[model samples]
Target: MPGPGSRPASEGPIPHLVLANVAKRFPQAASPAVDGVSLELARGEFFALLGPSGCGKTTLLRMLAGFEMPDAGSIRIDGQDMGAVPPYARPVNMMFQSYALFPHMSVADNVGFGLRQAKRPKDEIAARVAAMLDLVKLGALARRKPGQLSGGEKQRVALARALINEPKLLLLDEPLTALDRKLREETRFELVRIQRRVGITFLMVTHDQEEAMSMASRIAVMEKGRIAQIGAPAEVYERPANRFVAGFLGAINLFEARVVAATNDLLTLDSVEIGARLTVTHDRVLPLGTEVALALRPEKLSLARMPDSRWNNSLAGTVRGVAYRGEASDVEIELTCGKIVRATMANIGGARDTLDIGQPIFAGWSGEAGVVLEQ
Candidate 1:
């Protein structure tokens, strides 16, 4: 389990969900689908399992929902071991990517299906279903069948159905993928709002970086069936644990370098890629001549017609390509050493001065802008 500092501020001392040394393997696969994975989730925390396909995020989710059992280790919910619990008996509901609402059933019936199966009173189910519909903003569409609802509407209906059970945790498997891009973006905030209103822990599995970064209070980035890094979105994005994490999060320019000078608070590196010496701030004194890589995000590098004295590092390059992306323009610059570096310049004041291809440019960045990583 992670320390208290890893817990969300709203969480209590006890974790809502705990996975300890969890491992799983398929019958014919050479490697384990989930390997020695462990993490803790706080109560009411909106957490996300973020990774590409075949990274074990979905498998871990299935285990949490009791659809799949771990071959080794244990899963605990609210401090109770879930080894013997079945899917229906577990206090977890899953809203799958497909929504999976019954085509023949009315919206109200679909939302109330779980309660009806549990043999609750008709009046109680109706009342709870009505409240859930209102919560998801589908009260007006309750009488309509799933076939009549829009993609977003069907999604809300499925969400209402899942929440009507009042489960301790909700599992969302690619919850927003079915919607169009604009609608998907809109639903992200809507899902966050609904989760806050319900006040239940939401464990979502997703391959979309934007969805996880925007909606999750914390995210676990999985790679090759193991957690590469786990932290708040900003922390994981800004201070990635390794090269894989830095590259996976977004576009970054990495310069192969070696530590030439080291002090208590500063380090100097000779980078062959940039054809320049780079100075960056560091708290620890690494050994001289240690190989390392300097990582700078595209947004962190500023391009100018002339070198800026304020920059701790600067390199001369020719603009190879320029791409306009509305709010910002991505410029690809080729250094004298033939290394390519990308920089994103904001399109402030509507239309700014544009840089032409093959034009001379200087990319500069402050010492604080770069992150040092082990090769």
Candidate 2:
């Protein structure tokens, strides 16, 4: 149980769902699919499970959707234990990766299919279907078949169908995988709007880092059937739990260092590459001979021709490559210790004026910007 004032599994003021020590395993598999997973979802919150492929993100979601049962632990929704609750009986709906819209049926019929399954009155079903279509801005396309709609339209129809039932929880499985980059980015906002408007708990599974970071109120990063870390977007990005997460979430530079001196406020580390001293802000006490990894984000570093004395972490390097990304240029620097560090600088004018390729430069960052990870 969550303490008072703490966030629940679902998003809003109410705690609608809870997973306690949920674990699962499959035959012929070496380990569990979901191991000791527990999460509290406040009602109406949007949560995202993010990871690389085959990291048990999808399997955990399936267990929540009633498609798979956990081998150990329990699942509860709104204070009711969901033991053996069949998929149809659970107060949940899923929008699959394929959209799964009926190719032969019109949009209205597809959206109303769930209501029809419950055997609601024809008028009642029609009203709900109309409202759902209008909510998704697909009312004008009600008469069109799935084949007649564009990729985004078909996705909206699928969303409408899933929401029409008014389920307590909505599970989305890579819902935007089929769309182009531009469309995917646009639809993310729409999904957030729908979730807020309906006030339903949404649990989404995605491998896309940007997608998870953009829409999810909080994210749970899973690895090898276990949660590696869970926190708000900024918390996870700025302070990853381990080396894997530091590498997976975004562009990061990991430097191996040895602790030279330690104190309550700061710890000085000797870099293996540049042989210069590195200062870090740490809460956990570190021994003088400890080996640690320092994680630094690409954008946190500034490149210059001379060392910045004010910067706690500074290194000299040779420019490796410069790639223009329209809005910014990615500068890769090869340090004297044979490690490559990347930095993203805004293209104020253009990459043509930015740091030239093969130029020697110095990279510097503040102490607070680097996070020390044990692994």
Candidate 3:
């Protein structure tokens, strides 16, 4: 994770967009909306700003669009400072979460509205509009009004409008929020296709972790008006910088650990909660008596009916909770030491609901399963 983090934000070739120590605050507000944040986005990269509502994800996107000015730091796009640039003057376009398309205008007209406002030639606007419609697979519905189109179709229209300007950077504010679950899933792939076709840097703000994981090549997880972590989706999800990022991306079991012994290749920690000694295969030495956190995703743990010595950590427990989720089932096991640990098992060879509530089971995990979290 640390190795992956070093590249996109700091080590890559000159970025297409750079936000350096950016901060913004509202009038008399208790805290800044965006606080001391910096990130670099590569050319033609699909980057996601992911967090809960009011976590400054939307605020960051707004800053990129020039809708709100930052009180501190600077923004640079393609080697140009944006300090004096107005919203209309910037080489960027934003597609809002609402899909702000004109209801009265036809799809083609809506897509071409920006071109008309810019006073481009009529022939060029017509040809570009037609090409964009065909790009989004909406050529047949070019004459349809926004009200007459489905949610997905309208979203395509808004996207076409944004791209018609040929922005160097494109900002998307929860672009898939309006669609149904099925459509949203379908549109995720559609978005990837469209972004690849356009070959433009995409900066998207989304609260959906799955969306970020699936669509973004990299993600910046925001917390309380600041960035908590930024890296490739898998790297961030598997090796989070702290507890907030670890728990925010997905469900995981946490244990407070105290280092009891350390060696060149591993550090052994004692956790009273599980009444077990856990080993971590660490690249660096963990000092003795140091307090740390062990984060284990549910799927990384294995539960079985019989005891096995395959894992460094294993414990006897009783099943407390069970949730059947089609492909896999989540089970909460209460260890004899009065601690609850969750495990997810794929329903492949065995019955879907094998672990009955109150049934005895064994929970186990290898040293590599846990990520030693940072404070």
Q: Which lDDT tens digits does candidate 1 get at residues 1-375?
A: 233226555356566789999999988999999999999888888998999899999999999888889999899888889999999899999998899999999999999999998999999999999999999888999899898889999999989999999999999999999999999999999999988888989999999888999999888999989999999888888888889888888899999999999988899999876668999987678999999999999999988999998999899889999999999999999988889999999999576598899999999999989988874
Steric clashes per prediction:
0, 9, 0
Count of backbone collisions within predicted model 1? 0
Minimal lDDT window, size 10, model 3 = 1-10
* RMSD of each candidate relative to the true structure: 2.1, 2.5, 2.1
Q: Which parts of model 2 are misplaced by more than 4 Å?
A: 1-6, 9-14, 349-352
Better structure of 1 and 2 per lDDT: 1
Model 2 lDDT at residue 162? 91
Count backbone overlaps in model 2. Answer: 9
Please provide, for model 3 over 240-265, each residue's C-alpha lDDT reduced to its tens digit, 9 standing for 90 to 100.
99999999999999999899999987
- Which pairs clash inside model 2? 8-40, 8-42, 9-40, 9-41, 9-42, 10-41, 10-42, 11-42, 11-45
Off by over 4 Å in 3: 1-6, 9-14, 350-353
